[model samples]
Target: MSDLIELRDRMRAFTEERDWAQFHDPKSLILALVGEVGELAELFQWLPADSAAARVQDEPLRSRVGEEMADVLLYLVRLADVLEIDLGDAAMRKLSGSASRFPPDDVRGQAPEKA
Candidate 1:
């Protein structure tokens, strides 16, 4: 099975074991995902944007960042599964759409146009 599918299954089992499936509706999952993203953002909120990458590489911060990111991914996967959305396919299609909208030869080193 794909890693994403495995992860989704694991998350499902986790929720099921805790009898949390009732609370895993799309809206609640989305809110949980957003809260996780906020936690991740909070870790970098006071850092110099340019140094943020290096800052997260340190030992304690690195572990903290990883945990926050994993939380975000878990909630996102749970949300996608609840919604019956194919996250991998959706990601590929979105990437392709973005590529077509901003061809590299034409838009290199520039911000994407407002859609």
Candidate 2:
């Protein structure tokens, strides 16, 4: 979709602006993703799931979560881009795999692995 390409282009622009193309090679991009995930975790630390839901609307906290999420997605999108992956195709493949792994007729209310 256009949105995906737009995001890819925007991310490229960011790296270009900082002359960070060399540093953003796959290895470092993967590492940066892990760091950003940690930042997301830090924001939710010690919060109960129910309480955590509220943070989604808390401006400052939500901003941190949003940034971290975007960071992860940007790297993932770029990685897929580099690998010539059709993301929509990949997502559909995974969804089909999950459907086989978890048939809706019996998956509901089942325990984690048992599902």
Candidate 3:
């Protein structure tokens, strides 16, 4: 697997090949990320909570979820790359911020929460 730096470059080149940089400004990237997440959620439309919970067990459903997840993360990582942000540093800072909001000791075996 490639490191984030290599992956960022790879993604950049891939986008550049299609002249997509103009469409990937920060605001648009953020919107695209949200839209992809909405698409992911749409997969569970009209399903009961229990059925939604079971969706991950279905391989095809998992693939759809994975696709959306990858889209979200791709935009995020690319946004950071474009903004000259260090992925590791940014992540550590975010995790450090979370430390105050959610103590590691307190979070063990508990459900994750939105930050």
lDDT of all the models against the reference?
0.92, 0.79, 0.84
Runs of candidate 2 with Cα error greater than 4 angstroms are none
Candidate 1 deviation (Cα RMSD): 1.1
The window of 10 residues in a row where model 1 has the poorest summed lDDT is 106-115
What local lDDT score does residue 82 receive in model 3, on the 0 to 100 scale? Answer: 78
- Screening candidate 3 with a backbone cut-off below 3 angstroms (N, C-alpha, C), the clashing residue pairs are none
Best by lDDT: 1
Q: Rank the candidate models, highest lDDT first.
A: 1, 3, 2
Q: Model 2: per-residue lDDT, tens digit, 1-115?
A: 5778888788778878998887867778778778888888888888888889886788887887888898788888776666677776788898898889887777777864842
In model 1, the runs with Cα more than 4 Å from the true position are none
* Candidate with better lDDT, 2 vs 3: 3
* Models, CA RMSD each: 1.1, 2.3, 2.9
The local lDDT score (0 to 100) that residue 60 gets in candidate 2 is: 84
Which model is ahead, 1 or 2, in terms of lDDT? 1
Better of 2 and 3 by TM-score: 2
Off by over 4 Å in 3: 45-47, 50-53, 104-114
- Model 1 per-residue lDDT tens digits across residues 1-115: 8899999999999999999999998889988999999999999999999999998889899999999999999999999999999998899899999889988898998887673
lDDT by residue (1-115, candidate 3, tens digit) is: 3488877988899999999999988898888888988987788777789778786778888898888888878887888877888987779899899888888798977888687
